[model samples]
Target: MKKISQKNDKMTTVSLTQILENGIWQMEAEFSNSQYYAAIGIVRDTYNIPADTHPGLDPHCHHMVSYGMSGYQWGDGAVNYKGNRTEGNIAYKDNQIIKAEYDSEKGTVIFSVDGVQQPVYVRGINEKVRFIIYMCYSQASCTIRSLKKLIAPTTKHVANEIAVQW
Candidate 1:
């Protein structure tokens, strides 16, 4: 487990390792006591925490997906990119689980909270990936309580008692 703390919003940090191909990567995280906005997800290049860059808005870097206190968005760029307000306004609080499943062959990405799938899906992202954690303002803390990777089976295993509908 690794702990990352930000006294003020000036820099962003990325994981040293890259995500595995055809695997599901998950992390259990806990936000700090700050009332400000924070974010966590997979990112490549880094950007200055938005609140420090611009007031109110916490813009995301291009080619990443993050679930922040404000909302969840994905795309490419430092200032302008593709994103949307996550459905249900799902935000991470003191403790929550963030999961990302990458299908290398399909070039697809799926994000989830706890165990339920988040509607944010990114396709055609066939490049290597890394994890990122950041905040848009001062007084924020985020901890990666645990990290795990599950390599999904290439083929399905069916029991003999099961009937094949097809």
Candidate 2:
């Protein structure tokens, strides 16, 4: 497994090499000893954001979705965009698993803590995107547990009909 570390005083952002366009993709991450915030989300593959910049804070990249410490979710250059909030004001704890799932077909991205899905989600994303993470303080580190494409569930569409009286 490859590890990325930031031992400096400046904030840093990192992205995965895989590009996700269609179908559902999920990434699970665990943060340790982080200060300020450790953020995880997805960004457009074509965006040219600086390594020291936070993708959620970039006005040019408004489709990004990120969840960080203190139950904060940032997307479309706005904090808690659309009033989405985490349950119980959760904060980043050691070895706490945070999962981010993106469904391209639905043009939405949602985050979950451990296994419970959060209430907030971002929508209207139509571009190919890559998974990204941000570290805001020195000695902060993250472990990407898994990144994989999920099998799309097959469902049959059924039409509802109402009986009409003559």
**Which of the numbered candidates is closest to the native, going by highest TM-score?**
2
Query: For every model shown, what is its TM-score relative to the native structure?
Result: 0.62, 0.76
Worst-scoring 10-residue span by lDDT in model 2: 157-166
Compared with the true structure, what per-residue lDDT tens digits does model 1 show for residues 114-153? 6655544455655666656655446666777766665662
How does model 2 fare in lDDT? 0.64
TM-score of 2: 0.76
In the order shown, the candidates' Cα RMSDs to the true structure are: 8.8, 8.6
- In candidate 1, residue 152 scores what lDDT? 63
Give the range of the ten consecutive residues with the poorest summed lDDT in model 1. 157-166
